[model samples]
Target: MQATRVLLELAGNVVLLLWGLHMVQSGLTRALGGDLRRILGAGLRNRWTAFLSGMGITMLLQSSTATGLMATGFTANGLVSLMPALAVMLGANVGSTLIVQVLAFDVTHVAPVLLLGGFLAFRRGGRTRSRDLGRVAIGLGLMLLSLHLLVATIAPAENAPMLRRMLGMLTADPVVAVLLAAILSWAAHSSVAAILLIASLAGGGVIGPEAAVAMVAGANLGSAINPIVEGPGGDGHNPAARRLPVGNLVNRIAGCLIVLPLLGPITAGLQTLSPDATRLAANFHLAFNLAMAALFIGPLPWFARVLTRLFPERVAVADPGMPLYLDRSALRVPHLAIANAAREALRMADAVDSMLRGALDVLHSDDRKRVQEIRRMDDVLDRLHDAIKHYLTQINVEDLDERDARRVSDVLTFTINLEHVGDIVDRNLMEAASKKIRRKLRFSTEGAAEIAGMLERLSETQRLAAAVFVSGDIRSARALMREKEVIRDLETSATEAHFARLRAGRTESVETSALHLDILRDLRRINAHLVAAAYPVLDQSGELLPSRLKHGATHG
Candidate 1:
């Protein structure tokens, strides 16, 4: 009964540690996620910078798995090259160990201070960023408290015969120790937590240094596995997308295989670095990764070439109308599901953009084929919007926090707007183009130029709307609204100019009068659909006016 109680307490402490780590990860992701993405994007220029960027981001996030996901997503999207992504993974490994280095010391005294300050900030802070930072502080405090409790619980069991016998077996066979730690770390989805537990046992003298070192190797291997299993491009359908995760796991496996045979020498060397068992285990974890980084960083380009050959990008023969990022597995994780939905939403925007560009071509060329093509593209948008709506609705709303819930609504709104934009291009503008083609009608030169100008601006607004959808920046959203005004002015001027042409009895204007006006109206309507993406963002920031009416003025 006593042993069972000890095991249960140990498990509970580990749970608390995992929870704290989760809070830290989720908070930092919300607070600095965009900045980190920009920083990571900028840093991927070369291997050295990519390595440092990966380490810095993982350190901030406190989860290399999260860093891996970001890196993998960038690779899958063609945003960055595989070589630099591999370098980032190496840096992330080193960064994850730095957290262990800090926690290896006795820092339990600051827990209450952190908890008190964090609680006050979370309750009293007005800004979202402040609240997120407060959450980070609270997570840090919980982590320290859990570690303190873990040590206190384990200290009394140091001499328990059952505990000693179990640990003795682990110390006797380092292979079993490594495998056990790997399983625990994988199940927890956190090497940081797993290693902390192992270190605590070593510090408590319940396990020897060799067993702890073996377990550290296992923890490293285990953490790398989660990304390949659960990340964005992890489905085997896209081998190119799995390159970064698989490469990262390869490094971990190599490091473990190399260290296992040299356990005695490695543990002895680690002991020389730190006399305390906990610090010794932590040092080994750091040194192992640093060595891996040194050995692998330079050959990343060549290693990338090898991985590419092994997992060449397959020609996508699948229907383009099918959803790309909406993995059913991600629905269990609300944030991941949100990200998947966002990516799929972007696809809708992409189709709309193509339709806008094609609309300009059809209006100028009177191409029958282009009109048919634009209509087909509208079908793609409808399918994507439907898929996104169904996928998002499948996510349990009870599982979403305020931020995640807001993200879902934003993605749905953006996709719906894009779908409407597609309708304007296909049903209105394309139909007008088809009428002109069928009747052998042409626009007056002045009217053609005006229609082209509006179409150009519509395309620009679509791009801005996409940017707003992804970044949610208030300034960008405001700028998108400004473009809406510009488009409205263009439409009004085009209407007046068309009236002037009609009054002058311009032959081409008289011939295609209705078609020219329809084109102008449809272009303006499409602009409105594109601009709808910004309204929600501006409203949330309190930058949007409730209405354009004067104060207390009634609308009949």
Candidate 2:
């Protein structure tokens, strides 16, 4: 019963530590999420930049695993190359050890002050920034307090006969000790928590310096395990994205393997720097990650190439089926998330473009099989449109600047328009073509030429809208807006000409009069949808007006 009570206390302390770490991670993510992404995205110029940025982000986040996950998502999306990403992970590994290093010192007295200050600041919040900063403060305070609790809880274990016996065995067999620590670290989901516990055990003199060093190595290796589980699945998942987590695991295991045999010498050497057992263990963690980072940072390109060979891209993977850049992990960073959404919007436009081309194909050939296939393409557009909408909505607009908010609105408007265009093709134009084919009706040669010309023009307009969406260039957007007026004029003239042909006693024109007019109306509406992508850009530049007509003044 006494042992059970003691174990319960230990469990509570560990839970407290984990909760504190969670608060810090969540707080920082909400407070400076966009800036963090911008920094990460902008810093990937080379391996050195990647490494430094990784370290900087990890220090701010206080979790290497989160940094690794974000980087993995980027790699999966092809935003950052594997070599630069690996360099950042190296830096993150080093940065993740900072918590343990800080804990080895005596800062327990500051916890109450931090807790009070954090609570007050959090209560005073007007936006997420202040609240998130308070959250970090509270988490850091809890961490320091938990460290004190951890040492006190473990100190009594030295007098327990059963616990003492277990420690004796772990000290005698470093391999067994490491495996035990590694498993616990993975289960706990926080290396900082595991390392803090080990450091406390060292402080209590329940474990020697050598065993603590071995345990620290195991803890670091286990740190990479979470990323492995979080990565893309083996099947129906992104091959490139899975590599970051796997590669991170590889780095940890390899570093531990090399250092395991040298534990006796390394621990002995580190002992000279500190007679305190806890500091010795902390130093070993800092040393091990730094060495591994320096050793692997340069060869990351070769490493990435090898990983790609191992997980080759699937030959069957096609566009319009999977999202190219709409990564949920990116939502924390509004800028990257918006950029990803824009790319996905472009992909949706391409799918719509294909459907338009198919409608044109059905005009001359009337291939039932091909028309059916093209009609099904709208399903892909519908799914992608929903996906892009959900992704953009996940971004916290309250956290965004005016510029970013405008960018997000642009993406939303563009996807909505693309979806509308897709519906017009599937329900309106495809049906018209099917009816004409079913009745064995042939359009007059002039009508055929006119419809074909209009279809070709619509396709060109779609291509321009796609470019404008991605580039957000003012000139291109204005051109797209102008093209809308051109499409309207063409539709009006085509309709008038159809009536003229009907009055001339052209049998083909009279026979297919309804289908020809219906097709022209739908095509004009589709053009209007495609041109909507430019409205945001044109509005922002003051080159376009909200309502294209004067309210008070009328034209004669």
Candidate 3:
């Protein structure tokens, strides 16, 4: 009856510990919000910065797995380089040891005070900081309370013949103990929980020094499971996604092998320095992670090469059906979502440019094959436009700041213009092709040359527009607007020349002239949208917009 009561108490303590860890992790994630991504994005400029960012983020969140997963997502999205992500993962491992250190301290007396303060703060406060503080207090209190419960329950178990026999069996084979610990930790999905269990057993004399050390090592190896499983795999065909999990697996497996042999000496040396078995186990956990990181840091570049060789990058298909910017997970971080939207807009610009080029190809050649290729290109642009619209609708659901809202608005407007560009190219140009194929409608020599030249200028302008949007270059934006005005003037002049040719009976088809005018109109509208897309970025940067210049406005 006493043993049954003790087991129940131990089980309750474990539940409290798990709940506290969950609350802390949840609160930290909510408090940091999208800032985590921005910090990581800006900080991954070099290997050292990435490492530091990883450690800082993990320390703040109290979860190395979260930091590593975020890094993996960024790498998969091509936002950060692979080497920097690996560096960050290494740093996260080091930072996660801080939790174990905190758990090792004797703070049971302060548990009630922490719980009371945390509950009060959580109930009264509305701000993120207050909530975060409450979470920290709750986590600390529960950890201490659990330790108290564990010590109380397991202290009596030390003298039990059955418990002693079980402990002896575990100690008889350290390898089996290590394997058992690893399996339990993996099953629990919480290394901290596993470590806490070891700490509690060691504190109550339920497990010996060597057994505790083995368990600690095993828990370290088990912690890698979450990262490997949660990594990118929906598109496993993508080489980078496959490499991420493989690299993490190799790192953990190598760390385990190196530590397995040293476990006996490590525990002995620590025990000689400090008689406290729990302290020795905690130190062993810290030393193992730090030592493994130091050992692997130098060989990271070589590891990256090996990962790349094992999973070479596959070529991305130029299929317009793929929406480059519309990753559902991106909504969790609004800044990344905005960046992705801008990238998609640039792609839309390119699609429009391709459609225009296809039209020009049809104008230049009477060949049926060239005309058919243009039709295919038009289909591609149409698909891209549909995708952009759907992506924008999804992104709209995320709570965006003022600047991001304006950017989203600009992208939506730009997509509409690009869609119209596709329409003109597909409808008007295809109609002309059909007429030429069926009725053998032909343009005079001057008409053909003039139309081809105008189409070439239009395609060049589209290319520049895409470049300006992608690079976020103010100079390029201004140049695009100026070139657009030139295209407008050239279209006007070309229309007059074609009218003269029609009046003098030099051209047989007035319909071709009208189609040329319609194409120019659509091109002008597309350029206007491109200019609008650049406006918000320029305005945000304090660059004068064309409207501001036209109004003769100056900031005070």
Candidate 4:
């Protein structure tokens, strides 16, 4: 009964530690997720810089898993090269150890202070970021408190012969010890928590230093496994998505292979450096990662080449309708989720652009096959729109700050407008082209040029819409709105010119006058939909007028 009670208490304390670590990771991710992504995106210029970036981000995030996810997303999207991303994994491993190093110290006295301060700030802080930072403080306090509790609970169990014998069995085989730690770390999905648990057990004299060191190695190996297993597979065909995580796992395994044989000497060296079992465990964790970083950092470029060959990018023969960047795993991180949605939305815009260009070809060539292709393109747009919409809805509302919420709305609106553009091209514009082809009608040379001009202008606006969607640049948004007016003026002028050609009694204009007017109006409508992407951005910046009408003037 006493052993069971002690075991339950130990489990509870471990749960508290894991919860505290979660708060730290989620809090920091919510507060600085975008800036951290930008930092990683900008700093991954080379292996060395990528290493630093990875370390810094993981230090803030407190979980190497989060860092691995971010790095994987980058490489999968082709935003960064594999060599730099691999370096980031190395740095992230080292960063996770730093957290353990801090926790390994006897800072139980500071726990109460952190808890009190965090509670007040979290409940009273005015800004969201402030509240998020407060949450980080609270997590730190809980982690410290749990460690204190964990040590107290283990103190009584150290004298238990059953516990000692159980631990002794594992100590008999270093490989088994390492595997046990790896499984614990993998199951927890957090090496920091696993190592902290190992550290607590060591410090409490319930486990020997040799056993602790072996567990640390196992824990490190286990931590890398979650990312590979849980990461987005890019619809299960893109092997490039696995390269970064695989490279990280390989690095951990190599380090473990090197250290496992030297466990006796390494444990002795660690003990000489620190007699405290907790400190010894923390130091070993740090030393193992640093050694891995040094060993793998130089061969990264060459290693990248090897991985690329192994996972060779298969030619993407997949369906165009599938969502490519809406990574389901990203829904836990609001900023990353929004970015993924935005990327998917861009794919929608690209499909719409294709439809617009195809509509122009159908107008001139009257090719039945091109018209069918344009209709299929609209179907692709619809699928992409639905995928983005559902993906954004999956992101937890509470996880999103005001800024991220606005971004979600913007991505949805952009994709919605592009879908409308696709509809115009397929239903209205293409139908007009079909009528001309069926009736064997041709416009006057002047009318054909006018129609071509309108299509060209709408396409240009669409290109700008994609830019505005990504950057949300006020200047570009304003330019997109201005293009709306340009397209409208061109439509009005072309309508009048077509009528003038009719008045001149041109037979071709008379035969195709109605189709000419329909084509012009549909092109103008498509431009309106394209420029709608700018309104949200302009409204958010307070640059857009609520009403274009003159100050409450009455309409007759």
- Which regions of candidate 3 fall more than 4 Å away from where they truly are? 1-87, 99-219, 233-236, 257-282, 298-305, 313-345, 378-420, 444-457, 471-506, 511-514, 538-550, 553-556
**Candidate topping TM-score:** 4
Go through the candidates in order and give the C-alpha RMSD of each one to the true structure: 5.5, 4.9, 6.8, 3.8
Give lDDT tens digits, candidate 2, residues 340-421.
Answer: 8888888888888898888889998988888788878888888888888888888876546556778888888888888889
Clashing pairs in 4: none
TM-score to true structure, per model: 0.78, 0.79, 0.65, 0.88
| Ranking 1 against 2 by TM-score, winner | 2
Candidate 4 per-residue lDDT, tens place, 1-556, comes to 6777888898899999998988888789988888899999998999899999999999999987788778888887888899999999899999999988888888999989988888888899999888888888999999999999998998998668787777778766889998999999998878998999899888888889999999999999999888777776545757777788888889889988998899999999998998999899999999999999998888888999999998888786779998888776677788888888888888888888788788878878989899989999999999999999999999888667678888888898888889888888889888888888889999899999998888887888889999988988878887887887688889899999988988999999999988888888888888888888888877876666775422322122
| Per-residue lDDT of 377 in model 1 | 92
Of 2 and 4, the candidate ranking higher by lDDT: 4
lDDT of 3: 0.71
Return the lDDT, model 3, position 356.
Answer: 72
Question: lDDT (CA) for every model shown?
Answer: 0.86, 0.82, 0.71, 0.86
Off by over 4 Å in 2: 77-81, 112-134, 155-172, 236-243, 298-320, 326-342, 364-370, 382-420, 444-506, 524-556
Where's the lowest-lDDT run of ten residues in candidate 4? 547-556
Ranking by TM-score: 4, 2, 1, 3
Q: Candidate 1: global Cα-lDDT?
A: 0.86
Residue pair clashes in candidate 3: none
